[model samples]
Target: MTNPKISLILSAYNEEKFIKKAIESVINQTLKDIEIIIVNDGSTDDTLNIINSYGNSDSRIKVINQENIGLGASRNKGMKIASGEYITFLDGDDWFATDAFEISYKEAKSKNTDITMYQMINYDDESGRVYENDWFNLNNLDESFDNIVFSPEKTKNFLFDLSVSSCQKIYRNSFLKSINASFPEGIYFEDMPFFFHVYLKAKRISIIRKHLYYRRKHDASITHVVDANYLDTVEAGCELMRRFIDNGFYEDYKFDLIAYKINGPRMALMDIREDAKKPLFKLIKEDYEKIKKTKYYQDYLDNLGPKKKKFFLDILKYDNYTEFKKNNPEY
Candidate 1:
């Protein structure tokens, strides 16, 4: 067969229950000339069997079976063998809208962008709820830290507040290869660091406000089942911070990004409505000290007004951030 224009890579682990639906979503895509690379990460379940069923019928579907390497490694493996000009990633449990690839491909071609990101909707199966789509409005482009635009400084600032999810974006294969980009192996937040690097390298990017991806909430998913391993995600964020600093990207946006990472886990723990009082306080104190010792710390702290400075100091003092939730219940 001829080489495909796009390669859809899916890193799956024990997704037998939803794998078929995910595959069907891709098989039914409105766009043609695409190949599906399904990397089976040694699922003990019948995920491989489901993939074989599709592979048997469709020449475009290729399956790679390997030992239970993590998602990052699986994606890297798939990319190595992909023959497409463009690349897109999907989780095994997530489904895409029929027109997702079609629309994205057309827009990317028209704009000659290296990356294209669109809106996504979160689907909660257990709660029977579908959250409204979260989109990036490019109409009033700030060209600053706030609005999503294509500048190194603005991109760095945006990473402080939000890290791009792989599922939401499509990347040009040539650009990815030129940057030697691959997901960091054995990392929990595999998408964030790599996404940041790509955003920094991208010359042109397109943001489509239409919701075209369905991010399903499953019980067995990693985010739902938190354990000690979840700490790896926090460490991954730290690694990204260190990388940014070493590369001098942190000079302008050090404080904001550090604050975001330092408080990220604490905020997550708070959202679960569980008491993380002691550990949270300990982590806050440790991070605060680390920040204080950094060269940029004092200047960043000085730039913060009275209220914000007190807030960081209070995080070190308080056992838990539950008090903030109490005052601002909506948060």
Candidate 2:
């Protein structure tokens, strides 16, 4: 049998409410040469049954039933069995635009790139409002060319900018296999590190300035939940930073690395659980202190704007973020 043009891997864990719509989106894609690989990570709800219902109707729908192994492992499992020339990810709770695969695949082929990055629509479940993901707005670089290949330095900056989400991007199957890029199993925030590895190894990357995916946000989503699991961000950040230094890209990418470290804790302080906040903040603070001693971070701080410098000062001042916020309400 001939391989499909694109393989869409959907990782689900009790996402029964949105699984049907997610499946239908792939099945109805404008590009018919696609396969939908749904990994039911031991869903206790009717998610598996829903997947079965669709698998029966569409020959392209492949379902894998396995024990609850979390998103990272489930995605790895799907990738191992994928038979498509290009690969992409879609959360079971989210769906894609009908022409998503068609457009991305065409761009990847025409550009002969190892990866193709695109924008997404962030849909708020409660508010019923849709907005473009901020990553696109923040990237001031021009992307009007038919094929603008990212330079090596730009690739490092892209990874550091936290534009490392696995979704809303299409990757060449050969490039992924060659690099052996896979997510960290049994961990939260797995995309960041994997994204760094992929972009660093990729020789050619293309960007599209259009929204082709929908990222649904709600209270139940992992991103919105406030818990100890959020500490995984610190763990991932530290590990990736050390790896960057060890790999000898630290000298060139240190500015970005330091910026990432500083911004991470600032964002974490905003949403982490009240009880776990202080401990996580301490860890982030200690890591920052160590990173700041490096020449790269010191240089970055030398040129930092007054507003940002003040922000960093406040963040590093108190170990207890709760008390800090109370004392300085502006933060």
Best by TM-score: 2
Per-prediction TM-score: 0.80, 0.84
**Most accurate candidate by lDDT:** 2
Name every residue pair that clashes in candidate 2. Answer: none
Q: How do the residues 1-331 of candidate 1 rate in per-residue lDDT, one tens digit apiece?
A: 6678789999899999899989999999999889999999999999999999999999899999999989989999998988887899999999999999998888777777798877778889799688863332332323332223354544453455442688888888889998888888887778777877777778887677777888888787777765544556556766667766765666666667656565556555445334444444455556666777878577646655564566566655555556654653543
Per-residue CA lDDT of candidate 2, range 5-120, in tens? 99999999999898888898899999999888999999999999999999999999899999999999999999998899999999989988999999999999998989898888
Candidate 1 residue pairs that clash: none
Counting clashing residue pairs in each candidate, in order, gives 0, 0
Model 2 lDDT at residue 212: 86
| lDDT for each candidate structure | 0.75, 0.80
